[model samples]
Structures are given as C-alpha cells and as structure tokens.
Target: MTVGFVAFHYPRPEDFDDFVARVHQIAGVLRSVPGCLSADCWITTDGDDAVVSTGQWESDAAFAASFAAVAAADVDVTFDERERRPRQIIKLASR
Candidate 1:
C-alpha cells in the first residue's frame, strides 16, 4: 500500500522564513531517495504562523526506507520550537 507522513511545524514568527527554507531543503533530500513519490511543503497565508511538510512513498517498505535514508543522510536542519516542543507527525496510508 502507498504510505506517507505529514508533519506540522510551529516556529516563532521571527523564525518562519528560516524554518520554511530548512523544510524545503529536507524535502529536496527526500525527493532524491528511491520510491519517494513526492515531497513538498505548505504554509497558511493567514492565521497563526505554521508550516506543513509531506512525503509520499510507493509502499510501506518504501516509506520506511525513505526515513532510513533521510536519517542516514543527516540533513543539517536545526530549529526547535519554543520550550523544545516537538512537531506534530501524522502517518498516512491509502485505504
């Protein structure tokens, strides 16, 4: 089955542009991995500043492999939300 993940990132207003840039870079890295169907970023034009990133894989195993490759590559992205809050991650699969 096709699989994917979505993550919601909340960075202070001052860090918004930098955070978006880093997420785009990560998406670029994800696109290089085999079986990665898509990798992209999104943001809202209004409301509380937030960012979203998504990655889709051809299969469950492919999704896992993509994660492994991203981890192994160690994309240099370091921006933490205030008080070290973690980003929200949601897994996805086609029914």
Candidate 2:
C-alpha cells in the first residue's frame, strides 16, 4: 500500500474552518476513485491555521491516476494566494 499526505497552512485564520470543509470534500471525491482505500482530514489542537489530509492508495499509479482525474475536472475550490504551503508527502514510515 502507498500512503500520501498533503499539509495546508492557511494565510488567514478566518478561512480555516471553510478550508477544512473543502479538504473533507476533496476526500469525498477521492473515495470514489479506484484503489483509494481511505481519506481523512486533520487539524492541529493548538488552534493553528493548519490542516493535513492523508490518503491510502493501493499503489503510486493509482494515486497519480486519481489526482490527474481530479485535476482534469477543474474543481473550483481554492484558498488564499498567500497560504503558506501545500506540501505533498509520499510514504511516511508505515508500521
């Protein structure tokens, strides 16, 4: 199995809740894609404007294919231009 993660940092705390909802919505879209075992959203406990999304896929190809499809769809949800980062992570030490 392959694990993927995306970390998002909001430029403005006011948009944090909305961003979390959007991330969850993205996870919902991925749930229907083939080989996507699961997707989840997480937030920090210290009330920081950060969110992380984790996804489990059968393989790297599956992950790439699904992401391509989403990109092709041209979904409109977006965050502030000043957002800190959208870090893409691959394979984070599975137990």
Candidate 3:
C-alpha cells in the first residue's frame, strides 16, 4: 500500500473553522479519486495549530495519479500564507 501525509498550519486561530471546512472538501475529493483506499484528517488539540491528512492508496502509482488530479484542480491549497508548516511524505516498508 502507498500512503500520503499532508501537513497544514493556520497562523490565525479564528481560521480554524474555515480550515476544517476546507479539509472536508479535500477529503471528499480524495475519496472520489480512483484507487484511493482511504483518506482522513487529523487536528492537533495540544495548543498547536496544525492539521494533518493521511491517505492510503492501492499503490504508489495510484497515489501519484490521484495527487496529480488534485494539483491540476488546484485543490492542494489548504494553508494560509502566514503559516510556515512544512508537508512531508514517507513510504513504509513491511518487515
């Protein structure tokens, strides 16, 4: 399986609600993509303003194709300009 991890940060606390709404839209789009196994969003409640998305796919190719579609549609913009949070992706290996 291929997995994707996305990170987001909102500098303004007032934008939390709006950020969640945007996350919902992104999750919906991911679910509609072919070969997407699952997609979920997580928010940190530890006084840190960050949101993360974890997505599972059938294979790396599946993730690439779906992500390309997302980028093409300009749906990957979830962070505010003031937020400097960095996004990272990792590939897991089975033992």
Candidate 4:
C-alpha cells in the first residue's frame, strides 16, 4: 500500500505570493527524499487562504521517517497567525 500525507495551511492575504513560493521550494526538497514516490502542492480556486500538499511514500515507515526530517528542520509555516494543523496520513488504494 502507498502511504500518503496531507498538510494544510492558511496564508495571510499579503503573504500569498510568499506562501506559494515557499511551498514550491519545499516541494522540491520533498521530491528528493528517499522512498518518496511523488509530491504535489495545490491551491484552491476560490481565492481562499488555504493550501494543501500531498506526498506519496513507499510505506508507512518511510512516510514517518521523512516527517521526522521535516520536523527537525522546523518546516511548519504560520501566516496571519493562523494555526497549522498536524499532518494526516492515509493509505492509498487504486480503483
């Protein structure tokens, strides 16, 4: 089974560009991690302050290990004092 993680963030109105640029920078790093199958960053079309990033891993263990690295790097971002939620993990299944 492929393990996945979703991270949600809310950016400040004035920091929208900064938020997107930072996400792209992080995505590049995420793609280089070992056992990482794929990674993507997305924004909603409604012009909301929210963004979601998804990462696919080879296994649950691989996902957890990559998160440890992210945590050690203090990768969490806060915009307009909005709270950043914890990463959610899920198992991906094909149709």
Candidate 5:
C-alpha cells in the first residue's frame, strides 16, 4: 500500500511566487529521500487561494520519516501553520 501526505496552503496573492519558489526547493529535497515515489504540487483552476501538495511514499513509515526530515530542514517556511493530513487511498478497483 502507498501512503500520501496532502498539504493545503492559503497564501496571499503577493506571496504566490515566493511560496512556489519555496515549494520547489522543498520538492528537490523530498525527491532525494529514499522511498519517495512521487511528489507534486497543484493549484486550483478557479482562481482559488490555495495550493495542494501530494507526496507518495513506498510505505507509511517511509512517508513519516521523509516528512520528519523535511520538518527538520526548516526551509524558512511555516508548513506547520498550514493544513496537512495523511491519507491512505485505493488507487484502483477490480470489477
């Protein structure tokens, strides 16, 4: 089973670029972690003031450890202030 960590952020319009740049930096760090299958960031299409980041890990433990590393890095951003949650999802269904 794969694990996902979703982070939602509501950033000011003026801080959009900064937020994106910081996320890019964070993504680079995350990609280097072992067992990190994929990591992506998405913005809403309807001019919403939020961004969602999804990270897939090989296992639940891997996801937790990877995120711990990210938190320890303290990349000059306050992700803790954002809404974050871990979820387990079924990717496919058999008929």
Candidate 6:
C-alpha cells in the first residue's frame, strides 16, 4: 500500500532558481527520512517557471511518519509562488 504525492508549482519569474533550489533541499531532507522511497524534482524544457516534485513512501504509515520527521527537522518547504496559479497537489496510491 505505497502512497505518494505529486505537486505542480510555479515560481515567480525572478524566483525560479531559488524556488527550485529549495525544492531540491527539501527533497534531500525527505529522502533521508525512514520509509521514504523516492523524492524527485524536475523542471520542464519548454517552461521556465514551472517546477514539479514527487515524494513516494512505503505505505500510509510511512507517509505520516515522513511528515512528522519533516516537521521535527523544521524544514521550510514554502516558496515564492506565482500569484495567478500558485501550487497544485495530488495524492496517489499504488495499484
């Protein structure tokens, strides 16, 4: 029963690099947490301001544990997002 989250994000034009950097930093932190299977970040070749991140876990319990770990580590995951179309989140479950 693995679970995951995929997020679509848009950075302010001038904030793209900084936003992506923060995404990578957070992903790195999550990867070290127990039960985190994979954490990845990506940017589109045709889109300069778009960033995508995915976090996968071993199970629902693992997902919860990872969130707790992230909170305990005091990792700031927020970014300067685009005003018009901020961030979108999607939850996933393994079939």
In terms of lDDT, the best-performing candidate is 1
Against the true structure, candidate 5 has what lDDT?
A: 0.66
TM-score of 5: 0.73
**Residue 9 displacement in candidate 6 (angstroms):** 0.9
- Kindly give the stretch of ten consecutive residues in candidate 3 with the minimal lDDT sum: 86-95
TM-score each candidate.
0.85, 0.73, 0.73, 0.70, 0.73, 0.86
lDDT of 6: 0.81
Model 5, residue 17: what's the lDDT?
A: 70
Worst 10 residues of 6 by lDDT: 75-84
Task: Quote the lDDT for 3 in model 5.
Answer: 72
Error of 4 at 36 (Å): 0.6
Runs in model 6 lying further than 4 Å from the true structure:
79-84
Query: What is the C-alpha lDDT profile of model 3 across 6-85, one tens digit per residue?
Result: 54544456766766667667777777789888777788888787766667777777777777767767564654454545
Clashes per candidate (backbone, < 3 Å): 0, 0, 0, 0, 0, 0
Deviation of model 2 at 34, angstroms: 0.8
Tens digits of per-residue lDDT, candidate 2, 2-87, equal: 75655554545666677777778777777768988888888877776567777787777777776776676646456546456554
Candidate 1 residue 53 C-alpha distance from true site, Å: 0.3
Instruction: Write the residue-wise lDDT of candidate 5 on 14-64 in tens digits.
Output: 776777777777776676789888777777677775666667788877777
Report how far residue 29 has shifted in candidate 5, in Å: 1.5
Q: In candidate 1, what are the lDDT values of residues 1-95, reduced to their tens digit?
A: 88899998888877778788888888988888889999999996789577899999999887887777777876855654531356888999988
Residue-level error in angstroms, candidate 3, position 48: 0.9
